[model samples]
Structure formats: C-alpha cells, structure tokens
Target chain A: MSLRLQARKLACERDDRWLFRGLDLDIRAGEIVRVEGPNGSGKTTLLKILSGQLADYHGELFWNEAPMRRSRKAFLANLLYLGHSPGVKAALTPLENLAWYQALAGEPDDAAARLEALASVGLVGFEEVPAGQLSAGQQRRVALARLTLIPRPLWVLDEPFTAIDRDGVVALEARLSAHARQGGCVLVTTHHALAASSALRRIRLGQGGDDAGA
Target chain B: MPGPDASPVSEQQAGVACREPREGTAVAVRATLKRDLVLMLRRRSEVLNPLVFFALVITLFPIGISPDPALLASIAPGLLWVAALLAALLSLDSLFRSDFEDGSLEQLLLSPQPLPALVLAKVAVHWLLTGLPLALMAPVLGIMLSLPAGSYAVLALSLALGSASLSLIGAIGAALIVGLSRGGVLLSLLVLPLYIPVLIFGAGAVQAAILGAGVAAHLAILGALLAVALMFAPWAIAASLRISING
Candidate 1:
C-alpha cells in the first residue's frame, strides 16, 4: 500500500512571466507537504499541475514508480482535490452538497453518515438551508465536511483554511494530522501556518529575483 | 502522531480493499445527470427563460413583419426553426458557466469516471430542460405563426431531433469559451456555423410535410445528424473543457 509522488524539474510560465522553474517535489506515505509562496508565485498553479488538472507546464511526474499519465484513472481515484472555491452550489443545501460529493467520489449512498459528517462540521441546523443563505465561513465549512466523509489517500487542497475561524482551523489541523497518522499523504497550499504536531515539509516558490519590474 | 511504519500492512490493505468496488459507469452518469438536473431545478428561472424567449421571439415576428397569414405561414418553417435555434443558444452560455464559477467543473474533471460520459450527461440534462421544452412548445408557436396544418407534427418532431444535435454541438462551443469572461457573442459565432446543416434539414422536414411530399428523408437526415453528434460531440466537448480549464 506504499505510495510515492515525485516531480522533477518542473517549470511554468503564465502571461509572459515565469512563475517558477526548476521546481521539484517528493512525497511518500504518511507525509504532509505545504507549498508556501508569495502572491502570484504560482502556488495554485503548482497544485493544479500536481493534481493533473493543468498540463501546460513542463515537467515529469511519477506516482508509485510509474509515470502519472500511464494510470490516470487509478491515480485520480485515490486523490481528492479542493480548490480555492468551496465548490458549494448556492441553490443546494449542505446535505445535498455533501451527497453529491460522495456520489462523485464513487462512494455508496449513506444518508446517515452524511448527516453525521455535516453535524461534525458544525452544520447541524443548517443542513437543509440553501448554501446561498449561509455565511462565507459556513459555506467553507460545508466544503470542509468532505474531509470526514471520504477516505482518499492523496489530498491536494488549495487554501483549505480560507474564511475559517480559529476554532475551525484547529479542528482542520487535527483532521489533517489524523489523516497523516493513518498513513495517508496530503499536499496542501495555505497562507495560514499549520499548527500540527506532525512533521511538515515545505516548498517555497518564486524565491529568485524573477520579478524586477511591474 | 504515529510514524509512517506504525500502521500494519494487513490493516492498510484492508482499507484499500474496502474502497475497491466503486459505482460503475452507468451509476456515475446517472449521478452527474441527477445532480445537474437537481441544481437546475432549484434555479427554475434558468429553465424557463429560454422557453419564454422562444415564444416571445415567435410572437414578435408576426407583429414586426406583417399580419398577413399567407406570408406568416410561408415563412413559419424557417422562422420557427431559427427562433428555436436561437433559444437553445440562449441557454448554451450557462451550460457550463455556473458549474465553472462554483468550481464543480473541476471536481467533474477530477472524477475517475470517463470524462466523455460525464460530459454527455451534462449535455443530456441541458437538452432535456431547454431543447426538449422548446420542441414541445413549437407547435403552440406554430399555431401563432399560422403554420400549415399538415406540418405541425413534423415541426415538433424535427425540432425534437434537431435540437438534440444542436445541444451536443453547441456544448462544444460552450466548453471552448467557458473560461472567457465575455463569451456570449463568441459562443453564437462559433456555434451558428455548425448549426446550418441541422437548420436546413429541420425546416426542410416541415416544408416537405406541408407540400404532402415524403418527409421521411429530411427527418432521417436530422436523426442521422443527431446520431453522429452523439457519437463524436462528447469527445470534442470533453477535450474543449480540458483546454478551457487548463488555460
């Protein structure tokens, strides 16, 4: 069940500007890697590349000693990605959002478990309310509920802490650490410093003097 | 926290074994179709806007051009088809916009299910809500336009078949420009050219039926176009989506 993700000499350019070049990363089972970078430093772009969502970059990625492209389905099935947006449909309720997430992940129907997961996220009374009516943080919480609902080995989360309060951050850190303790790997990008006891690896982008003018 | 070596191999394998039996392709398709339908259902205006636009556009042509029944009936076949095509186009911009805005499109892209199958599901829902309704409502608009009596059924039938192809083909254009901020005009520009064949055959079906000729040929051609679009449009749409998102 051992899993490894490795990238070599990755490079990306956007709008005639070099965001990052000569970037490399490696992650194994039971690890949490945080990508740190300044604004416009391509942190989200890097995460997208790692998740196979973006292909314009120049790089080679290997998963479990095989080319990532060779077994995309197998790789994606074991991966969970949460982008900057909460991905909640405003027209839908929290329960419906979680249900759709579960279904898309190929998980079986379990209404009882979904309700418990929503409740654990502090959405007890807001399950049936339209997400458009919820606060920004509450909508973010609705997206965070997926952490407890699905059990994928690799998680590529982009700013999972945005709009979340202090207590929410603490609970989320605990959840990430728990995932690592269970031999799962997470590749996350967030501005907020994680307060987990587990060892955290860091990848800093745009360190060189690449942006001199404008 | 436990180190990497703390978990026993047997327990870890058990966890892997637990998640192996995923839902099949059919289930995945049904889930996507159901999710989109449910979301669109909640936003009732999205479904009704195009239908209303179709009826309004049909109603305007008579008052705008002339009240003469002979002129209206003579042009009704082309007018109805054109109006229906424009109505379908009205909804195409939104087929992927809301999902892309809310980030659900990224989830759909990341899903392990076949991309083409999932995209086909989305197009199916679009046609079901927009294209199918416009087809069913065409006869009423036809009556308003004084369409020849013999061609009423053919008008609806041709629209039902033709709009399926329109939705499928229009989806490709929609997917291509979904990332752009001002894609409405460009969507029409890209899709309208491809719609010519469907338009000719669809109106031709009604025209042939009005003249008491064998309309089977025109209807068959429309069906064939749908069959071809069904086979190939999904892949084109899936590719266009990838390009749009990755850009």
Candidate 2:
C-alpha cells in the first residue's frame, strides 16, 4: 500500500472547451477512487488517459514514481481497463472470451479458474454460449469475470454497474472492497453509487480541483 | 464446469497466481494466431467469400471480354493478378473491424506483449485464410483463362508470394480507417495506390514465365516487398490503431 499513481497539471481540452485544467492527483494502493462528473465532463477521457488508451490530452502521469511514458509497458502490465463496451467477442463463447484475455495476461497458471470465475459472475451454464446471445448484463459479467481471473494490481473501470443487476452490483462492490483491502487499487467512474465501506475517495470533475474527493 | 464448492474468487489469495513473468513474444503470437483462426473458421462464409469472388470475377472476364482462347491467353496474367488483388482487398476490411468494434483492440494495445508481434499474428491469419486460398485457387482460374501451357505453376507461385505483400499493405489501410463506421471506400482509396507495385511485379512474373523468360527477378522482387512489409507494416499498423482509437 504505497503511492502507486500520480498526475501533475493534467489538463484536457476537447473541441475548444476545457474539461479540467491544472489538475494534480495522487493515488495509492489499498484505495478506491471514484471519478464523478456530469456527462461530457471528461471522466471517461481521464480514465482512458490513465489506462494509456487515449493520448490526445495534455498531462503527466506516473506509475510507482516512474514517468509512465518511460514505463508504459510496466504500466500496462499492471493495469486492467474495462470500458463502457464489454470487449466480448460475439463469435467466442464466455469461456473462449476469458481464455483469449488470459493469453494476453501472459500468465498460464490461473487459467484453470476461468470457469469458476464465470460461475461467480452468475454465468453458470452460459460458459459455452456465445457472448452475443447473452443479455447486455451477462456480457458485462463476462468482462467483469476478468476481475477475478486476471490478478492485476490496478483497475480502471468505466460505468461498471451499467446493465448489471442488483445481485451483480452487490457482488462487484464486495469485489472492489476486497481488492482495496488486499493492497490493490481501482479508479472507477460511475453514476451509480458504490457501497464499498472504506478507503473510498470521490473526485468530482468540472470543479478544477484534483483532490476534490478528499 | 465449476464444482459445487466454487466460491466468489478470494481476493486474499495473493500468493496464488500473480507471478507474471513475461512470457516470450512467440507465445503471445501463437495465442493471437489461434484465436483469430478459430474466429475466422467459425465465420466460414466470410472466409470463403474472397475465393469465391476470385472465381466469379475470373469467370466473368471471358463473357465480358472475348471467349477467344488466344485473346484470353494474352491477357490472363493481368486478369488473374487484378482479380486476385481485388479479392484480397475485399477481405481486408475485416482484418481489424470486429476487434475494433468489440473493444478488443484496446485490450490489445494495453497488452504487455509487443503490439507489432500481436498485429503480425492477426495479419498472418488474414493471409492464411484469404491470400493463401486465393493463390491456391488461382491456377484453376488460370485454366479457365486458357493460361499458356507451362505458366500455371508460375501463376500460383507469383500469387502466393505476391499476396503476402498484399495482405501486409492492405492491413495498413485497414488499421488507419478501422474507427470509421463505413471505411470500405476510404480503405480502398488508401490501399489501392500502395498495391500498384505488387500488382506490377505479380503480373510481370507470370508474364515473364509465359514469354519463356526468367521469372526469378520478378518473384525475388515480390519476396523483397514482403520482407519490407514484414519489417515495417506491423509498427505502422500498431501506430495507426492507436490513432484511430484515440480519434
């Protein structure tokens, strides 16, 4: 549980409008940071920049005190990002989808638990079914299945509660708390309130303050 | 299937499975290749369409032009090369489309593995399913075109080598426009110009062989083009993917 990520003077302007400017932020392990803002407030853009997916913004990002630009591979190695879209292949079954992601993770040992992870997400017999045929909630569960199977230290989740059910929401909240407690961290953006008990920090955008949450 | 005792995954089992020693690039490449092959094979119709297009277009040339054997023979090299090139382009749109749509492309960009290596795997799968089949299928079309007696093997050889370069070049355009919902026309506009060198050399190989000249120089140049593409296209593809996704 140490200072894991830091951003300095991060500013993003899209279409001649400033989303956030002169923003400084620090994130440590064993913490859950929630990014909240009105729609078009650059919440998703911020998460994408942190995850190294979008590079159109102006900022400095650091992972473990090293500039992310220099250690991008290291940053990506420790990161897992789940966007609004579930990233599930329609042609691949749930098991197959998880299996392909497992390959990208580059760890072959924990693959045996993929079925159990799907089951935990309430996708019991749907393991062999094509993800496209599943409901949107089920498809989100397929992407969420990675939370259990892939053991990354940092997670950047965008609207993770969308299309998910009540039981799923509770289970995901519990997972997030457990992860924070285990020296891992998460930076999540959602309209739905998270019930994770402690270590929850809220950072509201459009206010021009990086530590607006604390 | 999970046994009855499978519980919600224990986050505290930190000692269990986080030893992520970077597996070699070859391992990532194999996994990507196998994943794409399985996906392309399951969508069998998409895989078959390009070869079918090649045959149908070759069949139309005789009806559209002339049925005279001598006339067809004189133009067969260009005819076969153009048709095969179009078939390869027809299938190129899918090279990164589905993955881009599904957000798998984002996952790929974030993989700790080399992006170029993984992209090369995907392009290799494209050639295996589309280009290789088109090359194998060209000789049959060569017969339909009344291609000269000894030039059949040369036609196949040239196409097989030439189409590898085609897949590589076409992939660059596919990557650039993958973000567009309707990139088919834009892709052709971007890729067709780059395809000219391959078209010239590919048709020239068969033409040289048909003319009873040394086909070695033409084939060597095609191989050289493939080598250059193999060296650089993946990096371009990876960069373009980032751009498309970011934009």
CAPRI quality level assigned to candidate 2 from its DockQ score: acceptable
Top candidate when judged by TM-score against the true structure: 2
Fnat computed for model 1:
0.35
Please provide TM-scores, in order, for all candidate models, with all chains considered together: 0.94, 0.95
**DockQ of each candidate relative to the true complex:** 0.38, 0.44
Tell me the tens digit of each residue's lDDT in model 1 across A98-192: 88888888878789978877876788899999999999999999988886677688889999999988888877777777677677888899999
Q: Candidate 2's residue-wise lDDT over B99-212, tens digit each?
A: 988889989888999999999999999999998999899999999999998998889989999999999989999999999999999999999999999999999999999999
Q: What's the lDDT for residue A111 in model 2?
A: 51
Residue B80 displacement (Å), model 1: 0.4
Residue B241 of model 2: what lDDT? 89
